[model samples]
Target: MIPIPRTLGLTPEQVDDLLTTADRAPSRHDNRPWRFHVTSRVIELYSVPERALPVADPDGREQRMACGAALFNLRLALHGHHVRPTVTFFPDRSRPGLLAVIRHGGTREPTPEQTRLLLAIPAQRFDRRPSGATAVPRNEQHGLRRAALDEGAWLHVVHDRPERALLRTLVLRAERLQTADPAFRAELATWSARSGGVPDCLPAGADGQESIEEEPLMALLTSHLTGTVAEIQVGQALQRVLLTATAAGLATTLLRQVVEVPHTREELRRLFSAARPPQAVLRIGWPGAGTPRHGGDVMTTATVP
Candidate 1:
């Protein structure tokens, strides 16, 4: 373990670079609900409640997850700088929005694998288009799972035929319920429009009846813990898995509708044998020729190392 430091050693430019990478983290509808406060000792992460999706994520689970993803990116950037990051989740219960505090622990050289993930950061994007017929290889799938494990979370790949079918039904049912809700539709429209994505339109995979049925390489992220802190960890795990897939030249789409609906989320919990609370579901595959709905410019940005 790296020794902890009392104060963060990052300069203003370094801090800006860290936040730039953090800002690129995947979010629900690209709300970018996280904020960072730079103190003399550390960089503090907070969730912007006003930026959260009230209708789709009332409990703020997705917001916290988004923040966690940002935190993970911040950590990875620190690793690239050869600075170990020490993170404290929910440092003060009174200030509930303050999600995490990251201190400059100590110096450590970046590993080759860490460098790979760091380089993969800019290439990560949310591909709402349909994936091609190429399947994710077994070794890459295992690497994805190991990425989650490294972050203290679980990745359940729905390989069994019956389980995959049942998951598809659950996803379709949740999509129907969400599409039927005027409030949900309105909220989704607002964010989609803001993000310059298809306004008032769900992604092909969001209502992905055909994709879910045909694509058997489905997976859901889970955790043995629950509530605020656990959700944050799940977010970190989610981003790690995403970056890992990106590095391996795979495409991924989030099937969050299933977890957004309470009833379906509970059903999914049962589907996974109640081992852990499901945070996010994913459809992973090789890239296709489909046009992307949103572009991730991290690969082009000089902010990330």
Candidate 2:
């Protein structure tokens, strides 16, 4: 076993706590495709390609985004300890798995927003609900938008019915194509089944069609730039937005089908006249009374090898 990087200014227990929280970030099939390597003074983030789902995420975009989410959580955990994290993306092109490097920076108290998000890290979940789509307040919507902007991304809230109708068409088309693929279905099942008999399966009504009509709120995460670095930024922005929504007592789900299919994703970009490519679509709303804040098998594939 490798010894802890004591020069990084974190105790062994603190390192364990930090990594546990970081691994809690949501992923496509909860794949947790992130690995951390601690050097004398920095924490490095890596993407484990073996953990990726090639059929569902052929280009490895979602896997990279998921690692980005882990990066955000790791940053938040550092903030919780009052240590600022200096981040660098793709520091070594020769080592492609090296997604980011985080060095300990100046110590500062956590901001109110950061504290709220830190507390919300555990509450955030990839919720699945067929109904109970209450409207998100305008102020909260703006807050979510700002959360994304803070991380260098944009959130486009879909409020127009006609625009939503077009998105609905694209989503349906993508879902149909995916479901018809035997490999896709098998890949989806492999992950869903790994949830240890939880209700993580793709149910009939959860096809995201009803969401366009009754989900009350839907938003797309977009970035001005494209490629690996932009995807990492979008992932961090996605986690920040999700944590903000959770802190505000909102439930969120990913309308991933819309962006998973290549042609459908292109059509979505055209539909929105987006200057940047869309990274993810979020279905945000309020959960019903008695609804659990978190309910699913929280798996951690975060390895320190």
Candidate 3:
């Protein structure tokens, strides 16, 4: 077992509150594939394999990455409470499910950087419509790229029409293929809210045909394919881009339809040879004028074990 910090001041209830709020960070499919172990002073984030999406994410890459984003949020939540957390990732190889162990290192005022990121959390939503606005401002784009870099990932904006068109076509093809496949369609349909559905299945709002239709751009986030470690890094990078977008008062929605197809995956790899292999695609923009505020709650609360 990992040693716990000795000087924690927050009660177990407070820690639970922080963890619940932090885990509200967006994830693919609302999988919520995370377990928390809260001691007197530290919180450990572990992966819950049962929540993994085997069909779409066979290797559990997206699940782990989503947890990494939660870990980042946990750090931010601690900052909001005026505590500086010391974080360790993958602390024990024997326990591969352990994603992070965060301890209350000491007290410090929230830094300017932390404050900016925290301020952006609530405003960020996954906008699934064509942004009425033009291109994102250059400075904001630069900031987004930097955010990914800081998290050990790179962000490439496809500016040229040819590249963008290729990505768009690939996405459309993947969407068609997934819709056509009986098995894939069955899985998707099962997740939908029928007259009656499994409590653990995908929520109604999360499984609409229109979710992927609103965004056209197919921006990819890639990582080297040699090892699981790279995939985890890519997930963290994806989260950084997301939070940064939120901070800028922008909206983001990931397009998993393209990456779900093996053929399209290969095509995207061929298209973006210089960047790492594409792990996921995201479309970012300002929310539409009449877009409803309701996108469904992606948050859950649990006792720390």
Candidate 4:
């Protein structure tokens, strides 16, 4: 058996580079609820309880998913550095916050697929506009399904008219409810940067003054939601799907308005009874040529050795 590489072999600068790349993973509400512990050859991902968004992610499902996304990015970064990463999920149950432990292993050249994904990291943005173009080609859609399976999740596309109508209704209702509720509005305002005039929220320019039109084809992610554990797994899978989409040169935006409401949530679940439960509704498309408005940058903390 090969012995695990200890901390003595890896330098602080290399570990810092891994953590920095991992931090770039897209997260809900811009709440980066994760931490990193680097040894010589292993990097451990842990959850930061204080960073959890209680209102938006009460069960910490999104939080864990955010961390999982980071974990995935870490793997990619290692590949970029010409190192293969070996990862163990939930390495220690006694320490629930410890999400995964990744170690540098045998050398292998980054695959074309990995290189494509790495290059896409900066260009990918959440596209909320109606895809307008025809539904994704059947072959591409099948490819997406396989990507979801790679992460242990299922992606169901809403193709039928009745199901699409039902989803549209649920989303409209949820949007109304969320816009009406003071708490929800406040949260949105906070995240949207409307509150306190913070520069970090999605700028008015990003969404434009007009509402984003809904696309005919939408996708919902469902996973077993047995408890908080299942929710986290769903989140991880969600990140995988999003990253895979990015790699495929597609843009995605999440629509949580409908699923935020209890009634709409139930309606969504009913639409996909065979799956666990829908975690998010995603709209995918090719972003037309246009100047993207800046949405502000993510906050990060750095420690110098």
lDDT of each: 0.79, 0.79, 0.65, 0.63
Across 92-146, the per-residue lDDT of candidate 2 in tens digits comes to: 9999999999998888898988898898887655456543655788999999999
Candidate 4 displacement at residue 161 in angstroms: 1.9
Clash pairs, model 1 backbone = 122-298, 122-299
Give the clashing residue pairs of candidate 3, or none.
none
Quick one: ranking by lDDT, best first? 2, 1, 3, 4
Residue-level lDDT tens digits of model 3 in 264-287 = 888888888844457777766555
**TM-score ranking from best candidate downward:** 2, 1, 3, 4
Give the winner by TM-score: 2
**Which digits, one per residue and each the tens of the lDDT, describe model 4 over residues 31-72?**
677888766556788999987666655667667767877777
Whole-model lDDT, candidate 3?
Answer: 0.65
In the order shown, the candidates' Cα RMSDs to the true structure are 5.3, 3.9, 6.0, 6.6
Candidate 3 global TM-score: 0.80
Per-residue error for 42 in candidate 3, Å, reads 2.6
* Candidate 1 wrongly placed segments (more than 4 Å): 1-7, 199-207, 290-305
On the 0 to 100 scale, the lDDT of residue 238 in model 4 is 68
Candidate 2: worst 10 consecutive residues by lDDT?
296-305
